[model samples]
Target: MLARSLEARGAEDRTDCVSFPRIELRLGKQRYWPQVLTCKLFRWPDLRHLSQLKRLCICGRCGRSPADSITVCCDPYHFSRLCEPETPPPPYSRLSPSNHWKTIDEPTEHDTARQLRRNEPSNSQNQDWPDSSALPSVTRDEHWCSVAYWEYRTRVGRLYTVCEPSVSIFCDLPRGTGFCLAHLHADGRHEMVRRTRGKIGGGILLSKEGDGVWAYNRSEHPVFASSPTLVRGHARGLTVHKVLPGYSLKVFDYQRAQALQRAMGPELPDGPFDPHSVRISFAKGWGPSYSRQFITSCPCWLEILLNNC
Candidate 1:
């Protein structure tokens, strides 16, 4: 209501402004979408003092922005100008009543089923997978069980959910190679020796020439045992899963592992050893069992691995 607003501002001398109450429109008991267009006048010749008046309102149909509209009255002719474009409803679909007026009859259930069948797969056998029991069990002495088992934290595979049902597991060897369970166990000891700089908490080194020892206070063994899931194989290649409670574990493809080794090159020892066979070991359970094992042992092993790498 520009007129009312002007009057309220003591500027009745300007042009007229009025808005009627909201009007509702319905079509066949259903309300159709509406679009509103409003215009505003920034200043009027006679209402120069009330130029600062700012009143913005929307229309019943579409909520158009007429906030900065300005109305102008030049002599006998009146003109209204709005800056924003008026958005209208999208065009009707080509299959509307106008195009298919006689097709309102519902299709029979048989007809619908026929159409669905026509587009369905020809054989159910094409989509069915062999049962898990039929699938080969992951070998216990697989090489991937070594490093891949430790890196299982970052493996790519289906996330298990009780509410949802699915089946997925990996059992193939990695591209280059993977460490076996025995190798992983033996290497874990090497990791401990390298990490503690030949002084694993209780001061024991694997070798006089080697840095630290894995059997420092008997804490590292449990840690290594807890991370024995690498024995599980993937149909494709090795896949690791992060099961540690607090620590975020990740599995790595060969490329990622190499990249990580390169990134850590600065910290690596000058040995000819490659980190490819070394995998991370995580403790089991949320209690002190997993934490104490990993915390005490991993650093020792990590230090060992770093030195050998």
Candidate 2:
């Protein structure tokens, strides 16, 4: 391909020239989990032209710049010039036989069950949860009604589907000491928030001042949050806010309260102060994994539904 490219150019080119056909690789039936490395090249016209002063044929086509581009990521052999290592696969467990593989086709029943089983609880939550009847009955006068709740989006603890089903609910939150939920620990202790693994953090505290909720990044790493009531509303669908460590974001969207407000509680007459239905998602890194994260929400306002309002 390089010889053909140079032949096609015919002469030394000064411009940032690049060409490649669409490349696809097929590895029999089980190729999905294997790492497919593609080297990325940058065409820095000025630098290569300068390097040409040494009479070096760095470039294959024009001999101006090197034909190879510096790689910034993912190609395992990238670290060194000659001694490159092999790219590894996902994990022994994730690999499946042809019969077990589920691509664009319908998943078999075993596949579905295997997928769902990944998000089960990890550690243990305190036993003293209020009964369903007690949740809706709690009043503004009671402190419990003032708090919010979070429910894991996927039964398999979607952040890392290969892991066990993690913690389900967090209850009895006080006005202060906002809880921090994160995926910091590498070992088994990741269930501090809700018994899940590989998740971002959220240190959520109810606003002492107003209906607002103040969220801080108590974890070592950064966290992202988003909601329909948030600045980048979910009407556009799945936007995000990056909340750095120690920093906080004021999250109170009374504007889009008509639909979500019903879940918050009947404190106001459908005007301001949307209830606990604030649904947001978090992840350790907002990559493809972000979509898999638990779509957690404040369960505090579930009382409104329990009241049959």
Candidate 3:
């Protein structure tokens, strides 16, 4: 069975489509289709029918070419299941107030009271400047207003404050950056560097924009990210999003965080959950889809702890 599976996979890799010998699969009295069985075995185990999956254009046998007689491809990787669409919030009302008119000679008591208050010194105007003691003293790091910081497995780095709009996090780039993980002497830094020496070309760029933090994947490999903002709708499981090279994604959304904060509860997944922190793994993805289950298990992963988020 293993040999046949391997042969089928090899043939599929070489060509656009490859067929396997038909085998009858049954549970009790009910029989399952070959396509459904293949999808369940390879793609999504919870997948029940072939209708749940959509074939990719790369699959030559799957309705792309008019000349081709084959309509379906049993290749599980060539098909992807549809995801539930997110519903947007309702629109606000635009109803205006009723208009009123009055004669120039008819001055009401309300108008006289308003003019009296307007001429009088207001409470705020009376206090021209606040007392020096009332104001909070600025610390050395106050200039940088650090919203977040990065961390390895156990070793934590300095607070990632940004005087500028954005900052670049790299491994061994010559240019200056806000934070350089390559200089840090973490436990698995050497191993991660060794594994992704040449592949870690141009690390990711993090920018603090309006109401959100964006992560641009400048590296060659994909970057996996998981945060409260990212997994706001998914209450049952943690959702890890993969950002391909050159692609950018909002890792942290303040507006979404505020909305989820009130509804969020203590019930979480098996691993440790830091509601204010975001975990990003470089080159490797660690989640339900990948071999590594958590970000800690990843060779090179970063934990971004947000402040006043």
User: Top TM-score: which candidate number?
Assistant: 3
Candidate 3, 191-267: lDDT as tens digits: 65458545555566665545466666656677767666664333344456666654456677667777666666564
Candidate 1: tens digits of C-alpha lDDT, residues 9-99: 3111223434333343354764421112121233333222112121211111112233323322121111111111111112211234433
Q: Put the candidates in lDDT order, highest first.
A: 3, 2, 1
Ranking by TM-score: 3, 2, 1
TM-score of each: 0.17, 0.30, 0.48
Candidate-wise lDDT, in order = 0.21, 0.26, 0.48
* lDDT tens digits, residue span 1-309, model 2: 334333432122111223332233344652221112222121111221111111101122322222253311222111111100111112111123431211111111222212223532111000011111111122343342121223432232223111110111112212222232232222222253343222332232222112233343333344444433442222222333454443344333333444555554654322232233233333232212333322232111101000111
lDDT of 2 at 93: 16
Off by over 4 Å in 3: 1-152, 156-160, 186-193, 265-272
Q: Rate residue 189 of model 3 by lDDT.
A: 48
When superposed on Cα atoms, how far off is each prediction in RMSD?
A: 32.6, 22.5, 22.3
Residue 252: error of model 3 in Å? 0.8
